[model samples]
Target chain A: MTADRPRTSLLGTTALLFEAPGETTLETQRRIWAVAHEAAGFPGVREAVPGMNNLMLVFVEPPRRPEEIEQRLLELWNVVAPLPIAGRCIDLPVAYGGEAGPHMADVIEHTGMSVDEIVERHSAPTYIVFALGSHPGYCYLGGMDARIATPRRKVPVLKIPRGAVSIGGSQTGVSASDGPSGWNTIGSTQIAFFDVNRSPPALLQPGDSIRFKVARVLR
Target chain B: MIKILSVGALATVQDLGRTGGLSLGVGTSGAMDPLALAAGNILLRNQENTAAVEVPVFPFKVRFERSTVFAVTGADCAGRLDEAPVLPWWAHRAEAGQVLSLSHPKQTTWRATRAYLCIADGVDVPAVLGSRSTQLRGSFGGYEGRPLRDGDELPTGRSNGRAVPGFGLVPPGLALPLEADGVPAVRVLPAAEYDCFTNSSQDALWSTGWKITAQSDRYGYRLSGRELNPLRPLELRSHGIVPGVIQVPHGGQPIIQMRDAQPSGGYPKIGTVIEADLWRLGQAPIGSNVRFIRCSWDEALGASADIRRWLANSRRLVELHCGERGGR
Candidate 1:
């Protein structure tokens, strides 16, 4: 066996749980993913899942004694350094306010601005994907215009329309599918965030960058 | 094959869990009480992760369309057939047309209770991923994407061996029951930034007890406790997370992730409930008091291993107490 492949035992299996580090969202996910990917390159590890701040490395048909595996994990985590995130950018088009987005007033009030001001401020800045959760292609993003930073709704909307563009505090996200939400809705985007038939399903991922083009009013 | 004479308040097929659909946002629907599921399987000498029936409350009943072997485990609720009291963990064989019924549990509230029935001949729900477990959110698995209702006909997998007897739950199952005493306290490992919280904040975390709100569901538990403020102006870039993640927002009350939890999160998490103690979360019904105690990473890892082993070996002994079913 390769020197990198240290064997240990536990739960009739061996696993390496890596404690990777990074304060920023993209950086942290990138580091965790790199270590997990690298672990898979080695033999014996059955599974390697990279999480927000950690990696769960598992063995294939592992030994029963866990202490053996625990010893190996400690050693592996010390050596594997995490990597930074690198990827391409994606832009989306969105329409602000009206029947499509009923909570536009709430977002405007929270931002202490007029509706036009809300649209301009929001569309002016770019956002980064922080994580993907709740729904497929549903991105919890960072880099919202801080001028519009506000707490979640006092009463969460029971059914946020699909494709609703909303902001929570300083973070922003696009709803892929209709669901409940506490995020203040400022607009709606026609962009499809998720499609079951797509090869990768979600249009965006944790490392991707995004920009928005505000929709103009129709005469 | 066994038949459904009655299916309590909530009953359906369950296995270890349903994965692969997480990225798609499907909840890994399975037996709330795994220990109970294992006992139901072991008593019938079935695989630990075999598909079994999970009965959440009263008004559920089943009848053996044909003679078969099966067992019931989890909760102290009495299983009856024509007023005959049956055991909980032991396997019991049934004659043709013999009806098996699970009565409502006497001990707890809205979410408390378990009644798993394992058949010697496995259930025949189509394998939707690698598991027979249900993804109730997507209406993907188990009986028509929901619990068993009246007039539902179940097919059976071919028996590994010809005509073996079955069993019912052992009396007084080991796990998943409330109104019991001195439950082993749940242990947690501080999150990546555990020390990020002020000493007062962290101390409050360990000392303060939060109530499990009724608003809780498969997605997450919205805990109610003291309002909290961060020591620093915090703005964390969103990141990935898992079940049992203790996410503390600007509001002091923390939201603990659960089975149907999303794969990632942006909220600042103070800690994670050790894998072993996650089951305790299921047992913690609404309005129950909960507290957290932090442990070292090493300790958390060690506990995970011990839990897996305990679950594996315990299935055998728990099955022993159940009544065996005799095949016709």
Candidate 2:
């Protein structure tokens, strides 16, 4: 194994996490997705969920020999290649600023940019889905412009409505459900990110790409 | 069928939890005290993962529309069937129109906050995403996807007619006791960023008693104690987190995620309360102080084994006792 190979840690006896070393990149995330696919089929493994650049393997039952599984994961990490998934590019029509986005002014204050400029930069890039988490159908997307990055709120909001598009630090994503959050909301989308009645509930998955379409600037 | 005459807040139908949905960001929303749920099911001869009503608040009242067997487990709620007192952790057959009332938890024997109402069969709710657990965030599953309210009626599954009344089992909390400095404690295993915290902070985590703040709930337990400062500020990318993960935000107060915790988070993790002991923590009352006992990987696994053994033994004993009694 290399000096900075992936590290493994236990998330209690319920699950174990395999975090890739170095910077978080699409390349590393792709590898994590690949590992997740392979690990999901392993004995005693219930689910292999891909995070930003990490993979958490939840156990159906706590393994008697966790070290053996760790060794196998280590060996698998060394040999497994990045598996690129053929994913769909979803277009999300977003209404930027105004009351829908309660924290647009905060983002403006932090980025020192005009509302129009902020909207343009935010929608410029087609973001890739790094993972689906936080709440049902919520996507952790990559490729947000660094210039628009804003620090999370010191105190998290008691509740943010679903479809609220927001940015936190270098990451950006849309809230899939109405719940508490600390991210700066910049816009709102009408797309239902998740529906339990639908097969494969989450609207987006790892490897999918999202394009933000300017529906109407509420500002 | 059972009609909710009076119900407290946050009472919902739950099974073993919704599993295999983490990748889609769906959390495992289920009973906080799963051990009590399991024991209740065992007493009534229901399936291990059968759905039950998890009652966190007190003075819950329900009327049996039909004669059915049921068991009340978890907190000793001083349940009464009509005017007859019903023993905690015992199976009983309720006649049609009989009202079952559970008062405030006495805390005489076990210091618990929640109670499980396990019917002979289970709560008949449509399983969404392969579980009957109430997904509060998504607003789906369980009884109309919400907590049981007054006048709400829930259908019970077809009873197998195997459950026999007049039998009881010891509560697992008493059978499997864990403590540190005479304070209730749960085992913890260091997590991914355990080394990032300063030595003193790490030491304090193991040594101090953290009070469960009023903010504690199914989502997470906000613990108040000595600040757990890291070696330096740390920023983490969002990742999958399970129940029992101890996350330290910028404020350094540790928040222990529970069953309804988001499927993912970005806060730095210092440790996780082993899953086997999550039931103990779940039953811990608000404002109560809980100690953390650092444990090795092997020891954590052993604790899990211990719980499994307890359940198995209890199930076997219940089966033997019920079999001896035969049909009443």
Candidate 3:
């Protein structure tokens, strides 16, 4: 028998993916996470992780087959989606060039904009946090202009300093911890993006939006 | 107590791993070869989830501070007491002030097998995210928040008061039950990007035996195979990742994720390895030719359940080896 449900993908044999129906990315993600979260709260749901565009769903109880979950998720997606939920917008202050952004030279060369001009251009737009979690509080923003998209470092560094703002292709992120990264450093922030003791350990989450303010505040 | 005569590369003590901390981007660092550790613990009659030593390049040495009972499980290597040969995959005992030496093998079989030195008690490291795993990236858990090193004196817990004499050791190039092969057949279930690959690449993923690259480890296995051209390299929403997820990057290189992987990722995953064969794959060594075959969830569950059952039956009553688990 054929299935009637929102677009679904199987993750392993025990998990189901629910993609929301929408022309735009955000609309689809909103639907996806809503249903995924609801399913996560269900009795047998093991884990529910929401992404910028999709949600990963897993089952807890054995014999909780993917097909059965798929059918149930389809019905759940139909009901739980279309709910009212607005993503948050987080503002960040950054100091591009000099030390904060070691990759500023590369960004300048790619954009053909002087250091000062590049900082002004980058801080002008409010970008959406398309996703997060490559690093703690590291948000992946996707509204970057094609002209400014720079290729990642050919040789990745083993430890990128915390709070270092970096870019790879069209996306920019604020690194919360020292890590091995291929992203080009564009700036730095003083924000402590993640603290396990904090209520919400991560400062940025998928579906959130952020606008950078070019300023120096590293303490 | 044990004195690490030599520190192996990127070694640590780990169990199954931790969860619920992906929100902070903390990776789950557990044993690379979970089966080996499981089997090792089982051989010693310890809890399957007990933390064990995870060494990379060379074997580690330990000088017991007190008389203790323990086990050595996983890959066959040159192990001994004061240079006397010893056998792997078995339990052993030591006296106070005794120096136990182990030398690294050529890795003719598994890429890595962490030794679970299950004492008369068990390792006493603090638990983080519901496990005693060592997250090197987050720098939490395991021995002193890292791997064991030279001159480290770890405490032992209440002993079971039993002793297992050390097993006999074999020299290098000796015959063993497991041998390193180039690539193994790993079973998988398709993922969200299963359709992204071209039909040929999809078939090749199963049909053509992919060779394991040199850069294989607990985090992931990098494989060299025919690039599976997906329908699109569409940016994906971040999703929780499990061990064995096959993630294909820009060049068509498929990296099979392992136990220490981050909790989530954005790369388009084609499928995940079946749980039953995870241990076999763990032993396959670099340059092994590997293929993937799809299996139902039933098969995966049955195999993992069997492993757990085997562990429960085989584990011994070991005393505590590390300190007590503290609040994170």
Check candidate 2 and list the clashing pairs: none
CAPRI quality band, candidate 1: incorrect
In order of lDDT, best first, we have 2, 3, 1
User: Lowest-scoring 10 consecutive residues by lDDT in candidate 2 chain A?
Assistant: A1-10
Q: Candidate 2 lDDT, tens digit per residue, A50-126?
A: 98888889999888888788889999988899988868998999999998788999999999999999999999999
TM-score of chain B of 3: 0.83
Worst 10 residues of 2 chain B by lDDT: B319-328
Q: What digit string (tens of lDDT, one per residue) describes model 1 on residues B20-39?
A: 54444444567666666765
lDDT of 2 by residue, B161-212 (tens): 9999999999988888999999999999999899999999999999999999
Candidate 1 on A175-194: residue-level lDDT in tens?
A: 87776566777778777776
TM-score of 2: 0.96
RMSD of 3: 6.2
Share of reference contacts kept by candidate 2: 0.75
Off by over 4 Å in 2: A1-3, A112-114, A216-219
Report DockQ per prediction, comma-separated.
Answer: 0.20, 0.63, 0.37
